[model samples]
Target: MTEPQHILVLGGGEDQLPAYHEARRLGYRVIGVDRRPDALGAAASDLFLCMTTRAPDRIAAMVGHLDVAAVISPASDAAQESVAELSRLLGTPYQPAPDAVRASVDKGWFHTVLDRLGLPGYAYAQSSDEAELRRAAADLPLPVIVKPSDSSGSKGVQVVADPAALPGALAEARRHSFTGEVIVEEMLLGRHLSAEAFLRGSTLATIAVTERSTTGAPHMITTAHTVPAELTPSTEIRLRSMIMDICGELGHTDGPVNFDFVVDAADEIRFIEMGARLGGNGMPLLVRHAFGINTYEAALRLALGQPTELTPRHHRKTALRILTADTDGVLLGVDGTDAVRALPETVELQLFAEPGSRVHRYTQAGHKLGYLLLVADTHDALRAAQARAESLLRFRIEPATPRAASAAAPRSEELTEQIR
Candidate 1:
């Protein structure tokens, strides 16, 4: 008899739930970590602890006495470097160099890398203080975006339409930044897309292209994401070529990478940002439903020192449409959750808020109250599933504390400052 292989998963949160679930499907022993005690992923883990997944040194100490097989984190940017650091210490196959992971976490380092690679990116200036930031913004193009250099989930992102709005936007962006630094960039307008791919020891596996739609502005909470993003063959090939160049430059090995881009009216693809992990917002999950391939599981296999399966098993149209509250209130309940779940088109449904739970309009991914995963054989069927979701599933909210209601309202890209 063989002892089960123990895998150290770096994050244990709702956003990381799929990783834990996939580990179980593969029958691997999973040890999960996070900062909170009540995290949903923690509950699903075989062993759970309250610890910051960002501390690589501390994590290394935790596994000091154990013969851990490999360390990996799926759908996590904050855990990327930690995983790399620990795996390097352990001499594992899933190792991505610490320098590359660090650059991914620090916007300043990321910008420098992109410039060196001659990747098409935005003109930007970095500032550490209000006085310096204000002075820097004064000269940049109008309607520039202000955001934390070291944060995720659009936490303190804001748009400054005019010079007068720069001060407030800077304050918000600074608040979310752990380093107290922010970046201001030239705002470009166009369609938002994400390139989902894998890097296996320098070889690129261009898997899926995703269409990203977010609330117009002011926190830019993602509203809907369509998998296998509809793209002309020429456009897809161009995007994949650009992605291969990026991965080649970054030196990504044995893991997934997600990149967001904006294609302007001129058809030029400008880089929005890059995340060196499985994409959040139900992306890896949607890929599994539509293509019958689980990238998250592939990450685990890579950690286990095995080859991955990237071939498409089925061709289906899929969408992950998230619903947010319109106003601040207590959730009464979703009307047809069971019905939505029963529908054949419904692949998965997750409701974050329960009856009497406080809910409100979107500020970030956390503010979303519920989500519906849909799958169909045709694009038209996919649209019908989304439409049925909107009609049958409803959020019942009555007035509560208006704090959430007072969040920044949505604005158009032209009307607000957009950033990478």
Candidate 2:
């Protein structure tokens, strides 16, 4: 009797559960990796490895003996390179170019590729030295964004509207930079949108344009995403064209790719960034619920060098709202969750924080306590359902002590001086 092929999946978080579930459904023996032993996907995996997914060499060395047929890192930017590396070492057909994977995560290199392709891009400067960063920020106009060249989920990202605040922002960016590099660019003012697509050669087989909402300025964490983003037919065409151009130029013309861009009042699109894998924050799940096509399964099939079916089974209105707390405190309870789940429009309700755990204000995507997915027959109904869900769901947090608050306040103010 023939044995089932082994499929290695990086990340075992809530967002990565779909890949693990789909892989199991496809009859592959799943091996899951994550630093957290209690990761949500661990229960779903056939074999779970407790380790960071960022180090490809360590993982490759550890699992090299297995007859791994394919490897995938769903919804994780940090694990894309590792996935590519393992695929190459294991001679899996899903090997994406290592350079392309690096470019997908590096802010400066991504913009450089866009410029080389004559694609729409913003004026940006990158450097590792603090003096150089200040000079770069000076050249740009007021209200610029400073961020680490290699970090995602808005970590160490800051908007500096004043010259006096440049140093502090630079320090934060540098602190988060895995490569100690920072990019300073003008803050493009416009409607933020995210595009999720699967590419076959140069063609976008399945695509979704989503209206992205973020907590405005400074920390700028994503708050919500509404699928089938309202766009003019012409604008949507241009956006699709741009996606092909960017992915094609980077030599990443296959598998899943998601992009972040801003469409200005003049209807001009400025590229922010792109990830060469399934998007994090339950994007694949949302897409599945809204379009009736599962990109997670498609990605797995693609990894195994098999043909995929990405045609939309149905088109429906859907949205995802990130759940977060309002202040730093101990989680006491979550109220009305049962009522919210009973709503007809509620597709899924996931809570990440348990009672007695620590929760913080929503400063970045990482700070989110959970997310709510909703779907309805019409856009208006979807919006109404979302409003209703928000009203019914509540996070109860016990306020932090005065001493603890005092101790945490100086961490930001003192970081600049210490980093200097």
Candidate 3:
């Protein structure tokens, strides 16, 4: 009899939880590692290893101890790096080399490669100094975007209209960037969508496409994602082809990759950015619900050198809407969860923050308090249900006073610098 496969999953965020469940459902031995002892995914895995994903030596030691058949990270860059390093040490099949992963993580390198390949995209400049950024702002067109070269969850992305505010925006971007390098580029105005693809060797298999709804201005964090994106068949084909070309150019193979793009009013698709792992915050769930394809299972199979059955079993529309507070304050309570749960078509409702926990001004994806997942027979129906669910939900926070607000303002910047 063949031995059961053992897979090591890095990090214990909600994104990695589904992979852990899927691995167990497939009868694979699962080991999860996270720095926080209270990480939710850790509770669901066969073995929970408490450690940071960036500790390469420690991760390597764990992989050796487990004799893991394969190592993978579902939706985190740190986990992706760990997977690459562990794979190299264990002589296992990972997605790419450390250098390739680095190229993907660093936004500056990613844009440079896209430009060199003559891909349809805008130019970008990376700078750490205030003077360099001011110069770059002067050179670029108005309404350019500023963001960290290596960060996720739309943490430091900002669309600046005036050059006078460039310095403050640059400082904000730098606060979220570990490398202290920020990229300023021409902002593409269009409909935002995300595409996921599974690669086996040189073959790229396109997954479902979804329309991404993000909080406009002040916060560009993704708020909602709906599958079977209201795109015509031809447009969908064109976007998928472009994404496959990007994957080929990047030499990404044998795992899941997500690409975000902007479809302008002219129907032209422009690149935004791409991640080497699965999309976060219930994206994999939507993919499975819409097409009956399990991204988590496929990722594990590919890492183990096994063939994946990339067949669609059903066609249904699904959506996930994040619940965010409008202001910063202490979270008093969450009401209407039970009401939302009683509603039809509401598949899941989860809250990430606890009572008494402080909630900050909505800045990025991480600031979201929770989310609701829904499904329906049609896209319109799904959207309607989502609207209803959101209406029934509420997050109550104690309003801050003037003196308290002043004290809280510094906390935001401090937290931002820590995450960087």
Candidate 4:
């Protein structure tokens, strides 16, 4: 029998499970590496290595001798960096340069590239010191948005409407940053749209523009995302053009690329952040459920140097809304999960916290405890399903003291078990 080829998948978290399973579907043995022993993706893989994907050198020590075919990370920055490093060592088809990934992770770099491309410009500053960050916020136009320079999943993001709020906001942003650096920029106001783009060596195969909602000011936590975002034909064409230009400039030679952009009231499109991998919060599942296509499988096929198809068989709609904790408390019970799951339009309903888990305020995407994922055949049907979700999903909380709050430990806000 021929030896089964091995594919190294970094980040053994729930969001990365699809990549592991997809690689297997393509006849490759999946090897996973993550910092946690109980990572959800590990169960889906043929072998699991308990190691941090952030340290590529360490991961290389374990899989260095393995005859790996390729490396891929679905929803993590650290893991993507490791994939680049491992790909270079293995001589496999992967983004071997850290700079390719930095085009998305480093906001300062992203802005510089945007200026080079003659796109919309936002004045920004970067620094690690809280004093410098506050000064940058003050120096930039008032109502600046401050966020970690190299973090994802809307983690450590804060919009300061007043100068007085800049200091605290800077602290929160710093908490989620691995490099202890933050980007302070002038706020871009308007509808934020999530860009779902799949590419293979600079070839844009498929793209989806989704309408996104977020909690305004203080902390910019995403509230909901709806696929098939209604846009004028001209606007959609322009969006696609811009996304193609971005992927080319970013040197996306292969695999999946995800981005979050905003269309200001002026109808100008500006991408704020991006990732060189599949997105979190069940975005791949949304694409599959909404369009009868699996981007996860597409990404795997690209990694293995196989021909892939991304044509949408049908137009389907997807809507995902997050339910967050208003205050610090213990989760008592989530009522009507069964009823919501029973709904014909309900694609997935996940409650992250158990009956007694301590839940914290929703400052970032990781702080969200549950989400209602729905899919419908039509826009009206999507709205109806959304309404049913809103009414049927209720969170019962064991309220905590007004002054008391759950102490948050430092964690990678991306690819956590709380994610899909």
Model 2 has an lDDT value of 0.84
**lDDT tens digits by residue: candidate 2, 177-289:** 88899999989999999988999876999898899988888877788899989999999999888888787777887889888899999899888988999988778877888
Find the number of clashing residue pairs for candidate 4: 1
lDDT (Cα, tens digit) per residue for candidate 4, span 91-140: 78644446568875688788888888898888899888777776667778
Per candidate, the number of residue pairs that clash is 0, 0, 0, 1
**Candidate 2 — worst ten consecutive residues by lDDT sum?**
411-420
lDDT of 3 at 172: 89
Query: Which candidate number maximizes TM-score?
Result: 2
Q: Which candidate is the best by lDDT?
A: 2
Clashing pairs in 2: none
Over 4 Å off in model 4, which ranges? 96-98, 129-131, 327-332, 351-358, 399-420
Instruction: Give the per-residue lDDT of model 1 (tens digit) for 1-420.
Output: 666666788877556787788887887777888887867767788877579988878877777666677787766777887888888887776677565576667776777777887877777778787888788778878878888887777777777777988888888888888788898876778888877777776767546777888886666667888877777777777787877777777776657887778877667777767777887777787778778887987878888788888877987788888777766667766677788898999988987767877776678776776667898887789888888767777676654545535646423321211111
User: The CA-based lDDT of model 3 is what?
Assistant: 0.77
Better of 1 and 3 by lDDT: 3
Candidate 3 vs 4: which has more lDDT: 4
Q: Report lDDT per candidate.
A: 0.75, 0.84, 0.77, 0.77
